[model samples]
Target: MSILSALTLSRRPATGFVIVGIFWGGFAAHVPVLKAQLGASDALFGLLLLGTAAGLVSSMWLAPRLDRTLGARGMQVAALALALAWLFPGHMSVQVLFFVSLIFVGGASGLLDVTMNARVSDLEAQTGRSLMNANHAIFSVAYAVAALISGVTREAGIPPGWVFTGFSVVTILLLPVLRMAPAAVEPEVGYAGAYPLWPILLSGLVVLVAFMSEATVEAWSALHVERTLGGGAVQGALGPTMLGITMAVGRFSGQVVAERLREVPVIVGASLLSACGVILAAVAPVPALAYIGFGIFGLGVSVVAPMGLALVGKLVAPHLRTEAISRAAVMGFSGFFFAPVFMGLVSELFGLRAAFGGVALLALCAVPLALALGRYPLRTAQIRP
Candidate 1:
């Protein structure tokens, strides 16, 4: 199927991806300023980020039921909640208030994340087309655009509050696109049976590793460029902007690749390539080299999580789709919030370079997990276009 067709089929979830991308891209670009405003040590900041983790865990438990309760309106509700939640953190100066704000941010984001991903899986099952990569590509595109805007705004001395507020308004403005037909209710009876654990676990691990690398870079690449490599604000912002651009290229490329290649080899090759990118960034002597590394890393890692989530959707029974995805997402999406903490602690104890080197090691760990996923007898008939 062509990209336009895939997007038309999956536009609702695609909007959710764009909303998430805009918020995070702006947040990533403004991290240095946000950190400075709070007067947080690296370790303390990492600890504070744990609030997001906590909220993520709670959202995972609540998402399936909430999705069921909200039905077709779930994405819109979650998006609005996320927009409201994001408004607080940028304005917060107190560490305690900032931490509390993150919990709400994480919870709202986690809800939207699970809802949109599961919606993509549902659309894929109904249409028998590869849509995840395409939808996620939209996210990367939005992220790159938002990061670039945030970079320019920061250089002009705009406060984080106004920046976040602008994005939130954009999010609210975009909500109409998320509307969809009411879902056919599945009986809740059979869903309580045991989900196949091994597939969920393995796929979740693959996503976890991919997002750990991604999260670390998104949260710290700017700092690495500025503090470690002695670049200025706009240059530091370029770090994530480069990553977002390359990731958009990679995921859009993957949408085409999925038509021709099996998922396993693609994932394994991407993992190895991402490992190289992270290692290069870790040892880079200057900001330009680090940007090259981040671009490479972004290209390789962009497809891993989407592919891993697709794997789970393919492997599980139809009745178990939402729950299995929520569980897998909880495991996978936690890495998004968790890696910042890991990066912060590592950067504190060692250095940003060393912390990024550790991310390289984490990227390599996905290889074996993908191999294990290949062992499962995927319902090949279901996934073919």
Candidate 2:
């Protein structure tokens, strides 16, 4: 299908994911600007980020319950909340306010993340099609574009707050777009049933490993290229930049293949691909080779989380779908939460190559987890919108 047709087929979740991508992409690029504006040290900013992680984890825990209570409206409110909360960080003058604002920002984002995934899962059930990967690909695209623009604007000396304020309008526009979506039905599965605990747990672990691997490369690839391989700044930038581009491409490819292939093989193949990429990067003698490995790693590991979540959506009782997803999301977010520390500790003890090798080992772990998940029985009755 054409891109426009695919997007039109899945407009609601697509818009939500893209908006999130834009918000975060801008936030990522403008972080240094925000820190400079507030005059915070690296240690202080690190602590403030910890607050964001805490809020995100806490909100992941809360999202299912919130969804149960508010149904479809919860997603709309959470998306808007994420946009509004995003505006606070760039404008904060006080350290305390900056930290507090991030808490709410993370909370809102976590909520929106889970809700959107749940809705996409519901949509999948309704349509009998695979959409998780395409939805996520749009997110990456928005993130890339927004980050690039943020960089350009920063170079031109635009204030971070004004940039973010302008971006917030994108989320606000989503309010009307989402409102125009067909009215939501009561989920075919009711909310009071017991979730299949072990299957969800295993699936969540797979997601955790996937995210951890991706975050490791994203956080440390440049340093690995520069410090380890003695590459110049431009070459160093190429590591993460290529990884980001390949990740989006890989995910888009996953969307194309997700429906054609069974979930287990896709998960296993992607994990192994990521494993090879990281391992190759670990052993590369030159910066150029390492960049290739990082790109390979990005392409291979890209499909892991989306496939896992899609599986969880298929396996769980409809009533408990949101909760199951939130549980897995918390696990996935934990990877994002600890990846820096994990990379730092490993690099400190064994060096960057060893740290990346360790990431390779982590990626390998997902293969078995994916196999284990394949043993779970899917629900006989599917939920449809």
- The numbered model that scores best in lDDT is 1
What does candidate 1's lDDT look like per residue over 1-385, in tens digits? 5777888889999999999999989989998999999999888877888777778778987999999888878999999999999999999999999999999988998999999998898888777789999999999999988998999999999999999999999999999888754344244444464558999999999989998789889988998999999999999999999999999999999999987787889999999999999999999999999999999999999999999998888887776777888888899877856797889889999999999999999999999999999998765323222
lDDT of 2 by residue, 332-382 (tens): 877866765667667766788998999999999998898998887777435
Worst 10 residues of 1 by lDDT: 181-190
- Estimate the TM-score of every prediction: 0.95, 0.84
Off by over 4 Å in 1: 181-194, 380-385
Clashes per candidate (backbone, < 3 Å): 0, 1
Candidate 2 contains a number of clashing pairs equal to: 1
Q: Evaluate model 1: give its lDDT.
A: 0.89
lDDT for residue 119 in candidate 1, whole number 0-100: 88
The ten-residue window of minimal lDDT in model 2 covers 178-187
Compared with the true structure, the alpha-carbon lDDT of candidate 2 equals 0.78
